[model samples]
Target: MGVFTAADEERQRGVRRMKTIATGALALMATVFVLAKWAQSAGAGSWTGYVAAAAEAGMVGALADWFAVTALFRHPMGLPIPHTAIIPTKKDQLGRSLGDFVGENFLSGEVVRSRLSAVGIGSRLGAWLAEPDHAERVTAELATALRGALAVLRDSDVQAVVGEAITRRADAQEIAPGLGTMLEKVVADGGHRRIVDLVCVRAAEWLEVHSDSVMDAVTGGAPGWTPRFVDRKVGERVYRELLRFVTEMRDMPDHPARGAVDRFLSDFAHDLQTGQETRERVERLKREVLGRGEVQDLIASAWNAVRTMIVAAAEDERSELRVRARAALLSLGARMAADGRLQGKVDGWVEGAAVYVVTTYRDEITSLITETVAGWDAEHTSKKIEAHIGRDLQFIRINGTVVGSLAGLAIYTVARFFGV
Candidate 1:
């Protein structure tokens, strides 16, 4: 006997019940036979013979079905008949067939697509994600995933990738035209005015601090043949004129010097955009900048700084970046819940994405079913299947027995009426 757990005990009880019913059927047929034999010995009518024949046929039918059903699970009466113990003997083939059947019927693309469509995946997903807690959960999960990915990447690898990308981008695209266009826009919009103002302010402060340097440059640049006093006077005049010019330029927004500066910028922009010589010079400058070890170091350092900052922000719950991300997620959820138009747009996007996946990779997805079935150990698979579905199959034998008896009785009655 096998080990008897509660489930095994229950299955045993069911088997016993089936056996009892079959046994009772055989006993009933046997009792009918004994009654017919007794009646015949007691000088009963021909009806007794017909009843005996029907009961005998019914008994045969019941026994045959019992044997067929019992043969599946074990040997009938311990006899080694051909095709007996079918489940154990042919379990592997049955499993393969089952696997094939499931692959063909259940895992087909049409079935999957139809089922997904019937489920209203997009609307359901949108409704679920529209909840604030759900959105927050998703955001947290995304953050964790990003953190894990960043942690797994080596810094040297990332630095190399960044450096290569920057070099490739610089090599592929000419920068002068774009820069010139941008510069032209800045100058036209007076966006460079603040920069110019800042420069003027800094220059005035520097001049105030370095008055002795200015006086010395003035004196040194003076002619040697002139008298010392006259040279000093001339230097004083030059210093005063320079100071006055600087003050006027700083105070007067529409000074001629400011106009000259703007005109110079405009011409430079035009030359950068249109002049071949200017573009060649710009290219040379770009090459020089890219060739520098300091530039490469800066590029590598930027990657390191970004990687460190992201890892730190991801690790810290109190970090502003994470807090802002969570708040943004919650706000989006609130909006999605409240706004039908936004929800509809989101649903449309989701549906489109799902459809695209199904259409593009439906074959690969369906092949997973076929491949997985093809890989299973067939005998184990069969046993597992039988464990789940065997109880229901027992009913087939019960129905056959009951139906066979009714047919047998009907045939007997018809034969009696025909006087057979």
Candidate 2:
């Protein structure tokens, strides 16, 4: 397809106008040369000789310049002259040279780094982001990006990845030590006391409400030979003692039973931490739980829940998560804008990253430029370039004509003065 655009067509028209003007000047010079020669031959004025010489030189200069300008884009007069049609014939070489120039200058690591450092991009960005409106806009854009990323992800694939990662991590690291340490801390800080108190209160309440059931359970296990009255008395006594112990434990926080319970938990925590058998049992239980299909399903479902929550929050402009994220971003931006040290750090990071990329891919980038230019059709490229610059080249022909006329007239005058 042709690459000639409307703008190129306009520029071509302008070039044609200038060309016509310059060619007309050449034609006028030739006519003046013929007329002045005839006037000199007829013994009209002595100045006619000088005029004829000037016009002849002007025509020669204009034609020479026209040939030079035309040769750049195409062969002059359609003749296959050597070194003519320079642009069309040498397009690939020119592209390579241009690519090399860019790679050596603009795409160099030093140039890129210096340019970026001078721009102060980090500080300017920070200042812009420090504004409330700018921060809001950035937050909205980030939310949109987050939603798009989530939407592109396949749930089954992500879930499988997440599930495998969790399982692998859990299997690789033993949890007994951490759990034991946490339990020990909780016990030491009396964090489990409230739980103990709750258990005691519930036990007492159950005993009070189920006295008959408790007594019956105690008496029903008596031997058949035992007297019915003795069994009944024993059951009643045992039930009363059990209810009283629970009531005391519930009412008194510093009861001996509470201390005993604390000691038992402390010992259990220690065993969990240091006892080989206990750790092995815990590990076995962990393996069993993880091996269960139900547990696997639950683990996979966790990803869905998280994805849903994040998507919902991203979609909601007024969500707590979004609001907090926006506030955090604004705060960070304000800090970055005001703190010179942070700005410098950011600038250094950006410069380093840019330098690294340019240096690493400099060859590839330059090759892309060279290959793209080489792929362009040479004839079309010549036309495109000539359209941009032909009008300016026409001025050269006009200038050459004027300068040649002046030079020729001066030479002719000197010859006449010397009586040549």
Candidate 3:
């Protein structure tokens, strides 16, 4: 049985009071009938016959109406009469019919569209959302949802997915041509000159500081048959030449070495683009780099870092992400509230979505009503329905009694006047 609410109890009480009044009317009619018959038996007056007839008819009408009303909820006097207790016996049938009725009339796409269009929910919602408080509340809710989603996701799984995606994308796409094009552009724009200058400067400074080391290296590599003094003097001479070359390259922008370096880079860029062997070499290098555990770890770590940053931003109310989201929502809401065309578009979208749901799931939507009613206790259902409308039904019995009495009196008066 469904829970009997306080409101239902109040309605039941009202029904009881109306039932008492209707029963009292029936009793009064019976008492009048008896008194009228006794008066007629004592030869009181001709009007006594009319009063008896009226009272008798009133009692008959009251009992007939009462029987009809009672049969709807239960059998009269608990008898096993056919067609009695209509609701209890046919509850399932009634429920199915109710569901079918609702599906056909209420869940139809046309009905849903018409109702939603009339509501103008889009513009109204926009007006409400345009408020600062509403926008802030929505922003908070969105941030909470984002944070919850991030919390639910495992970082390791996300990292794996991100790593695999990047690896797959890298493997699928050829990078040598793109790299060659980028390098060629850099050289043409003289962007490579700064790097050349940096390298030259560094080399010159290193040679100046390591002159003794350079001499020792040259001396060590010389022939052993040569005299030690001769090797040492040759080493010192080689070191000086090396240092002077580096210093000149650093100072002169149009040095032969600098031009040679530029030509080498330009040729390498061309080979990367047009030479199959060069492209293959680059591809092999790319595979080797991607296959390294450290590189993969670095890629996965990047995703982890980004995920942590986003989650943190989502959790913080004062974060730029949240602020921007709130501002965007407020702007959208304001636009929707003020722009009639935007309002119409929003309304159309909402209406279309509602219509789609109702039309697509009409049966499923209606099944809820049928299933809920079927689950309820049939006796409780009957009682509840009676409680809701029983008070009004009692009035039918009272009306029947009064009307029956009037008809009876009129008939009796006509009979007496016509000498029938």
lDDT of 1 by residue, 1-420 (tens): 123467755765665676677677778887997899799778898778767776777677777877887777668899999998776676656656665665567556566556665665445665677676776687678779989999899888888888888888998888888889999999999998888888787777777787777877878887888788886777777777777788788888998989998999999899889989999999989988988999999998898889889888877777887778877776676666667777667666665666677657656665655465555554554444444455555565555556666678788888779987
Pairs of residues at least 3 apart in sequence or in different chains that clash in candidate 2? none
The per-prediction CA RMSD against the true structure, in angstroms, equals 6.4, 4.3, 4.1
Model 2 residue 298 CA deviation (Å) reads 4.0
Task: Please list the C-alpha lDDT of all candidates, in the order they appear.
Answer: 0.74, 0.91, 0.91
Q: Write the per-residue lDDT of candidate 2 for residues 21-115, one digit (tens) a residue.
A: 99998999999999999999999988899999899889988999999999999999999999999999998998899989999999898999999
TM-score result, candidate 3:
0.78
Q: What are the clash counts of all predictions, listed in order? A: 0, 0, 0
In model 1, how large is the Cα lDDT of residue 382?
42
Segments in model 1 whose C-alpha atoms lie over 4 Å from true places: 1-63, 66-118, 121-163, 211-259, 291-367, 398-420
Better of 1 and 2 by TM-score: 2
Off by over 4 Å in 2: 200-260, 291-301, 311-338, 410-420
Relative to the unseen true structure, what is the Cα RMSD of model 3?
Answer: 4.1
TM-score of 2: 0.80
TM-score of each: 0.65, 0.80, 0.78
